[model samples]
Target chain A: MSLRPYLTAFGLQWKIGLRYRIAVVAGLVAQMWFGAVTLMAYASVYHAAPDVQAPLSLRQAMTYTWIQQSLFTLLPLGCLPAIGDAARTGAIVYDLLRPVDMWNWWLSASLARLLGNAVPRAVLLACVAGPLAILVGLGAWSLAGPASLISAALALLSITLGALLSATIVMWWNILTARTLSPLGSYAVGTPLAVLLSGMLLPLPLYPDWVRPFLLAQPFAGITDIPIRIYLGTFIPGGVATGLGLQIFWLTALTLLGRLWMRQTVNRLEVQGA
Target chain B: MTQSPSHTLSGPGLYRRMAGASIVAQLRYPGTFVIQAIGNFVTTLLSFFGIWSLFHRFGSIAGWDIGTVAVLYGLVNVAFAVAETLGRGFEVFGGEYVRTGSFDRLLLRPRSTLLLLLGHELRLRPIGRFLQGLFVLVAGLWLAPHVQWSAVLVLPWAIAGGAAMFLGVLIGQAALCFITVEGLEVVNVLTYGGVEAGQYPLTMFGRWLRRFITFVLPLAAVCYYPTLFSLAHPDPLGMPTWIGALSPAAGFAFLGVMILAWNRAVAGYVSSGS
Candidate 1:
């Protein structure tokens, strides 16, 4: 499959998305406001109870929360509805007729979307959240800066993989389920699962002995906890490597599964050429 | 053979028709509704587990016992569920309807936009969240061993107030969508973030955060203050105990302001199409 056409498509999407810059800025402002409120809430709780038994310090927790909140926007919950709509309306066939491979083309489109939507918004959140973190005295960890960058990268990768997985599922399922799963599944399954296993709300060390193994085994942990742990210097360099290994493992697995689903559903494909 | 311009349905009749239509649509998908309800109940229940784990180790936070915290959590969920059931369409308006231009259809209808929007979707599934809230609320009563009939009478009123407050936030969010959909994440700070904030007593937060919730968002007026009155706890904010008892009324007032804001936003959309 030719890569140039996909790149061109990505560029087009990015330009289209960039047109709504004002909305993007507004979204960032809103995130910052909410982040400030949440950080303050946590600070108050920690102030009230300095001896809270979480693994990290109060500052670390606050920063971690900010990171999690910011990264949430980066994650692709599902854009299956768009895929389904395009397929249903006969756009998919037109896309297939293009020189680019379907998977690569879609990936390019999603990348463009991420660039237009998540990247600027996340940067804006970071800029706003940075001062708030400083004001709240939450940036005490020596590893925060490096950890945040690594976590953000990992978060982006995880979200891309997640979106692909969901898209593949849409290929297998009908459009209604695909559309419902993309949004609803992310919140119902993905986000909550991430919260539980990723140690977003609570640390994994705090869980009971038997539960830890099961929680760690889940893919959600790889999304936030492992990356955050790497950032906090909680994990040794080797541990970080292993964490990345696990993430890659899951990403590859999900991707292959998605591809298989896509191949199976292609025969049933109906699309509107754009 | 001229028609009277005043033949259209008004007030209660219009509301009843809208409400009936919404209910019918909801009933059309009873299985989906049941599954969604179960999902809502389980996810909400899981969040409480996080708090329960905290209590397991620390006993109480900020001099507030598990029972008291449970009451707060329960009330917040109950109120949010009420809002979700009534405001599903608006809750998803910014992301789903507005983004897709489906909101324009609502404008085409002769009914009040607010009424039609509210009636567009009613999620029976939030009944799961409501029931879970009821369980926690009863547990709080059981643990606290409080038996004030007057406070009991105020419970429904408090729920109503909380619902109004939550719905107001959703409306505010929908209004914001008129300007931009990019940074809509900020609204989560008020809606989901508020729920998290409301889960714990306001006293647990820092002074600034507390003041913000009290004076700015008036979240204190809905959950904390009324909780104190209902549970017979001291008024931390030092308002009259009656203030706690009557604070839910503030939710209605807040919602009223949001409605006006919403109308203004709709006007802006009509003029600018932004």
Candidate 2:
């Protein structure tokens, strides 16, 4: 199939996602506020237990909170809003009848939407939380950069993969919306799952020893936790290679399974007449 | 086709009858209803698990144990859940009512607009969050070593105040829709963000943040102070114990102010329209 249709889908979605400049700014402020609160909580916790050998230092944890908060909108928190609307109005049947590869079409749109929402806010927030805060005499509390040049480079690469993995997961949610013919199910299932498992709620390293590995291995962790860990130059057990490998593994695995699921869902989609 | 004005119901009576109708409509789709409720339960449960795991790793955070924090967590969740259940109409008013001009239909009714809105608010889906929160509250109370008969008596009052405060936030959000339909997403910072902040002890936040939530939003008044009062825990910041019991009044006062603001906003909208 020619790539033009998929590219058109991507461009359209990218523009729609960027149209909400006000939302980006507002979301930035909200995320910043929550990030600061989480940082202060971590500061108090770490200070109170100075004797304990925590996995991530206070500064690392603070930085983690900053990055996570800045990228809060990046996660696939629910089905595509467009798809949800389509489902509600019975317009989704047209989506399936389109003359293009369904998976690639939705995948391109999903990725564009995620990046479009996340990129501007991430850049704006990093400036305010990192350099601006330091210049304004809040240096100690400002978000720190990568541990080194190498870490920064690797983190950049890992984060790209992480974004792809996140978009792929959103495809599953999209298909779920198609099957249920309701967007609410995807959101009801998506929000808390992503928030908890992605280490947005708490740093996965902070969990108990028994649960740490499970948290680390989850697909959602690959979305942000691993990339953030790489940026912090924290140990990733096997190495940076292993961390990158885990992300690629999940990406490919999810894409294969998701495509199959999408095929089955589309085959069975039955729109009811009013 | 003469309408009988004498048949009009009182505010509470109208609310009960309309709310009962909404519940029956929701119950018509049992499968969707159960899925939503279960999904709600699981999502909130995951966040609780995040907290539980953190406490498991470190015995206490800043002298606040899992049980102590759980009291704050449960109280906030329970209150927020109640608000979410009963204020669902106001919560979606901007998108559903104002944007579509269906709010005019509400204004044409013989009943008070507030009662009509309240009648639309009694959603059953939030029963999931309520049940989960109750489980945690009971566990927290059981594990907390302190015992006071007054604590039991104070719980319901605090929950009521917290619920009202959150409902006020939702109402304020709806009122803002009359001014600007876009960028209202920032209000999530108050509703969802407040719950996150309230889950932890007040002292864990910075001085300014603590002041904001106390004086500006008064979430700490409805959630934190009342929690401390019931737990019989000394405020780490050294406020008198009686303040905890009395502080819930701040929440109710805040709600009254929001209602006044909402009325002013409605008047503005009416004047600006045909």
Candidate 3:
């Protein structure tokens, strides 16, 4: 298939995502604040009981939190605002009329928006949380580098898959909005599920050992947790390959299932106005 | 109409009726509401579980155990949920009212803007966060080693104060919208970030953050200070025990200042004047 329409869709949403410079800065500050508080909490917890054989060391957990906070926007928080607006104003019908493949068009936009929102914030936050914290004599709290060059390369690949997996999840929310005729339901359901499961609130490795396997197996874990594991070179159930495999698995499975769901939603959708 | 809004309701009665009607409307979608609430509860509960898991591995963090932390967690969340429910309108004021030019319609009404905004809707979703926090608080109180009988008397006072502080943050955010609606994420740092910060003991934070929350925002003054008092935990941070009772007043004072700021913002607002 031709790539022009999907690229245009991607470009449009990417520009919209990058447009809000102030919001990006604001979100960075908020994430920084959260990261600081979380780091402190971990520090105290780890310090109070140094002898415990915790799954993640204090440094690893801090790094995980910093990266997680930096990539906060990469999580599938809700349906795309454009889709929500379209659904609300009956402009979604025009989206249906567009001559491009609906799934690809929406997926490109979803992926672009997530990248646009996430990339700048992640870079800026990494700089501040990594180098800047160390420069300011807070090296103990800084975001550490990947376990090795191999891990770094693998992490980059994993994060790309992570972002795509996140966008794929957003597609599910988009289809849900199209089905429900309201974006509220998507957010009400999507946010908590994504935040909790994706290790946004806490690193999946830090969770109880019994729960860790189930947490790893979940689709949300593939979005960030698995990639972060690869980055930290932490134990990923079977091995590092298993972490990357999980991301690829979720991305492919979700995309295939999402396309079928989208087709069904569109088949049944009835726009109120002509 | 079955009943004229003006005839049966006036002042606080009207506010109650407004809240009541909104509740009734939400209740119409019982399934949706329940799902959202359960999602919220589980999401928060899982985060707490992360903390529980850590404590399971390590005996305590910074001398405070899970129970004390839970009390702190419960207080801030319950407070935030209450503020979020009541202040949903104010939270969305800039986007829903100012950006849409609906602020003009609100002005056209005879009722006070504060009442109208406060009455917009008592959101049901945060109830999930509230209930989850309450569960943690009760559990924490039971499990904590350092409890006193006076906790029963002091806990409600602290919750009221924390709610006041959060509401103040929301109002301050609404007031800032008068200047620009672009950077509201900065305020989310205070509100959502505040909830995260309040879940831990105040002393655990760095000096700057501890001071900012205690003085500028009073989040710590209301939450951490009172929890310390309730648990009868000695001040690792050097504040006297009696300070908890008086510190909650800071929350109220913060709210008063924010109200004035809101009124000033309204006065300065230049309508489209069509």
Candidate 4:
């Protein structure tokens, strides 16, 4: 299999993702606002009930939020916008005609797009929210360092796997877009499902005891929650290995299931002329 | 300026007709609408679950119980969903209209651009969020420890105000597009970010942040004061409860100011020579 075509697809998306420098800044500001509001709410809640043994300390939760906000773009919010535009205008016919493996082409593009958007924003936000914040007398609210050097290295590996898992989830959405010939459904489903299940709204560790395990078991958990715990060295039910294992597991399972789905969608697209 | 061919229909009347057309177009694919609506419902519900789980552990946050917080959550979500549905055009105006140079075409239309934009689509998807919010609201009312008939009277007022305030934010964002289409996402900070903040009592925020929402954005006027008044909860910040009944008017005031700004932006428009 020639990897050249896939590399080209990846590069195309990576450029498109990086082109919007101003949007990145604007999105960062919006995310920072959300993080600040959420942190304040957490502080109030934690203060109101000093006696409760919460799953995460106030500092841990605040750090969790800072990281989550910085990496907001990394989550699978929707299908590729190009796919959506194509589906809307019937330009998807060109995509169908491409002489390459459809799954790899779209998957590589999806991964590149997520990374291009996420990487810069995360770096800029972390710098501002971590060290700079402390220098500016907001140390109590700054993003803390990883629990240890080993944890930092492990978090690095886990986030890479997490990114792969997110891109795979996006592939499912792309297939859904191709199936329906509209992008709206993918977004309507994707945005909410990812935000909730990925712990963007609240850390998974914070959910009620009865539901905590189920949240951990879900595919979305692999995207962020598990990796965050590994960095913080917070308790995962079976510790860090389970977290890494879940990421690899979901990446493999979703890729297999998603590839099958993609093939089915392609067949249907052929049968129903664009 | 070209005269609207159908002058018999005022700007608002045209909006009604256009909105009705959009509703029909959307309903053409009822299945898609249903799925998106359900997705929106689930997304908000999941966030509420996050809140519920927190309360389960702590019993209350900032001296407020689940029922009161539910009202706040429901109010903000319901308001945002309504504003988003009506302001869909403004929300995407930068990318769709300005970048494509379509704003020039919009200007030549006989009808008011604002009305035309409002008519772009009365999105049904937010109905999912709307229903979920209403459900939580009713549940909150039932679950609350103290209730007077005043809630029924005040609920409509607060929703209208909150929606209007959010619509103001959207209009301001669209106006900002006139100068730079590149950095529009910052507006989401005041819109979506506002909803997140409004879900909690305003006192939960730090003093500076608290004042910004109150004096600048007026979110507290629409959401916090109203919730406090309805729940008979005292303002830990020492604000008067009577303000809730009247403060929603600030939403209308904010909208009016944004409308003036939109007019200026339209007047200053230099077509994106695309």
Candidate 5:
């Protein structure tokens, strides 16, 4: 009913997320290294198969790799680390006792955490990989920006939706952690699924033809791949509206389904113990 | 209690007993064990699919066919999984051992700390990643049509060496916790990031990077060179044919250096405590 608690939850989690300054910088270095490695791999693959007629050019693929790598923390890799900790320590019961909409409270907290971790790294990496690399005369290997002004605007809108979709998925992982009372399952299941399905492992366009459609339609694609494609000005078979529409559809559908699941899980937890 | 010389077991026997105990403790919860194992396998399998789709599309990248890359991918995954299975204790050492002051408990034991930690490495869950890697290795070997009896002998050795290298990385990460726990995650760049980089051929990278992995990290020694030798593929950079046979030793040497670092870190912790 009241927005105060949820906003407070958001603000608290955001601060916690930002506290790991060392981790953010360290993670940036690692991501940059891996991004460079992946870009090189892409360059070699594209160059080796010049006649293959891939959907994205080598430059577009390089840019995609940079964006994906920079935004690696943004992907729903697992449930909130705090939830995992609380579940382990039996402190999660306190979360249930709070006088707020549990779903919104958790959702806002999760979103704040995601954005808090991702935005700084994304900004720093964009500078280093995009403008800084260019400044250093490594423009060929640097990340190319959004294809056009309109493409940039749409990409910004879609990435916001994408972040929400990712957080929604993390909610499911959180609920799973709550039910299981162990953080291990969420990570063991969440990580590889997100990395592969989100096209963080490879550009969706680079996958085989039959698999491409499935990759495009999957909810994970809505997280990063669709937006990146839109940013790159690649022609989506059903166009940009369809891409944005799919993300919205998944966000709404998943939120509704997740809320039901959370309610049932809470009831089960209450009847027994978290 | 009276101790008898005749009742004293060898170091290997003690290690076996300790490892066996850990394995039994892990299996105490069969449901969670199975789920984690299966989850791990599925996760790695999905990542492999990313490669499968790539090969299915472009046939090969940088003159390395899918089969060759698969061999490299499988070997590295299998090696990393083996390390993860056995060295899980070391992997969590920063948070679980040092921060919790469990290292003091370990020091109180009569057995050497390295042996105790080594014994802790006999975890079971990584079998999933192991099985998936083996599947890919077999598939790659089958598809490649390169028949070499020596490869059978060489493959296991390469895996063992690679596992040692990764275990060494884990140890180095643990050592860093003595100074600061906050930034130990950067070590993941060497461990997890290494695995990702090792998935592709070293030749795919630039000259400087190729040299760094070969001479510095020595990934080329364990993964790239050995696979090249097995496939009988000539080096584009023309290092030498015999380099592959000797490269695994690089991993062993790296492990040796990490052990020295670990010793220094432990000593620092001991001195700082007073």
Candidate 6:
């Protein structure tokens, strides 16, 4: 359960990953190229129609897409497959036998992997988006500092919780069957639900009368949309407080669920005789 | 339930048997299959909603009406869904097959690598997306109230071509993974980014992007020009409607190039053992 062994494990994985350094760099470059294409498309669309709905101006939409592309680094959709693979291969048994708390061990491993993967990719994506952001004249708002920090923190929390939840599912079902559900859970259930409910996609005022309350009720909107709103200095008094409160609530709930699942699954561990 | 005989299959027949087995393996978990199909449908639907919402807000974009845009969306989705389903093997080749070196096993089989890979996985769930696309296409046709029988007849060819193009992108991605998995993002610019770009008319983009899609990627050949012809919209790019009608053929040519690249990459991998 100590941090030393976990850190060692993390370091080992990092080294192995580094051996394929070219592949990693290539992947980053490919992502940046697409990011550039996306920026260009957004710019073109904005030029064609200067105003895409009331609240979302050409600049804001471009900025929003940039931020979204950048933060996409923190998404946990990819982690579940790793968990599922380990479970399927019965490697979870070896992973669990290590003298570490199951949750802490897995979390550390994933965090290490994420750092190995996301950090470099994020840097590259930012480099790509930064020039485009400037070229598109994305304003350097005063709130960018606070908003970005908050968004980053939220993104990390969301990814961790998402990974845990996904890992828990893999513990029950192996990778082959889990493939379909995991992506659905991550993409269909988690990301968009978060986007829609968190109020990230549209501001509350812009939403129709019937949908506003429902959209506000979902926890996901708070993850990205709320931070963006705050960055834009559009957060009203009560809404900002409520959004932050909801984010904390969701994080706590997800963490608890993950822990419970991990404990139960580990207790029932039936490592196949390999 | 009677299972098919294993020994009776040979050569192309063996490949068919293998493909059938893979499909059956997927079908073993019908619940997962249904959920995944629904998930894909929902995700694709959300994208359509995004486009629809834009149309609702702006009435028209780049001189294209909602219905015309819907047709474009439908065509792209239909093509993409078919590609995602049939080309599931190629899509995962980089991450799953090439990364694990299972591609060598594929080569050892007494069948064309393409057939064996195509048979490796068949995603039935994207059928949900395909149906949604079909609905959209029909709706667009109804809304436009146009009946070009020739264009209608060529629709299948275009869809096949588009599928081939996307599949080629996936294959190319897998091939590049051999060289370096680092910049898989560039492939996304062609695959995922292409889907988004193809959803709208190519003329909506800047000259550079349009040319990239047309010459480098040939996406416009599959979707935009044929769409203009189908909707009776004048080609802003000055290409005749017949060219659009014939554009999907380019997709096959693209696939041919990718296959050659894939073969070379595989040969290099075999020699270098990287």
Query: What is each predicted model's overall lDDT from 0 to 1?
Result: 0.68, 0.87, 0.88, 0.90, 0.87, 0.63
Which lDDT tens digits does candidate 2 get at residues A130-191? 99999999988889989999999999999999999999999999999988888888888888
Model 3: DockQ score: 0.70
Which residue pairs collide, candidate 1? Answer: A27-B183, A30-B186, A44-B206, A89-A272, A90-A271, A90-A272, A91-A271, A91-A272, A147-A231
Where model 1 places Cα greater than 4 Å from the true spot, the runs are: A9-19, A44-53, A87-90, A95-101, A131-143, A147-191, A194-210, A236-238, A267-274, B1-10, B88-117, B123-125, B145-149, B170-188, B236-242, B256-274
Clashes of 2: 0
Question: What TM-score, computed on C-alpha atoms, does each candidate reach?
Answer: 0.79, 0.96, 0.94, 0.94, 0.95, 0.78
Residue B165 error, candidate 1, Å:
2.4
Best by lDDT: 4
Please report how far candidate 1 places residue B118 from its true position, in Å.
3.8
Q: Which stretches of candidate 3 lie over 4 Å from their true place?
A: B1-10, B105-111, B181-183, B272-274
lDDT, candidate 5, B83-182, per-residue tens: 8987887877777777767788888888777788888658899899999999998888887656467789788889988998998888887788778752
Q: Let me know the TM-score candidate 4 reaches against the reference structure.
A: 0.94
Clashes of 4: 0
- Candidate 5, A1-274: lDDT as tens digits: 6788888988998898899888889989899888888888888887888888888888998999999998998899999999888888888888889887889988999999999999989999999999899999999999998899999999999999999999999999999999988888888888888998998988889888887888898899999999999999997888999999999999999999999999999998732243
lDDT of 1 by residue, A1-274 (tens): 4568877877886777688776676566655555565555455545656666655666676667666666554444445335556644655566557665666667666657655666666676666667655667755421146456766676556545544433333233333323342234434444444455556555554455467666666666665566656665564335656666766676677567766665655656544345
Best by TM-score: 2
- By summed lDDT, which 10 consecutive residues of candidate 4 chain A come out lowest? A265-274
Give the per-residue lDDT of model 6 (tens digit) for A159-222.
4444333333322232222333233344434444434443333334344445655655554554
Candidates arranged by DockQ, highest first: 4, 5, 3, 2, 1, 6
> Which 10-residue span in candidate 3 chain A carries the lowest summed lDDT?
A265-274
DockQ of each: 0.38, 0.69, 0.70, 0.81, 0.72, 0.35
What's the lDDT for candidate 1?
A: 0.68
Identify the CAPRI category of the predicted complex in candidate 2: medium
Clashing pairs in 5: B86-B121
* Count of clashes in candidate 6: 15
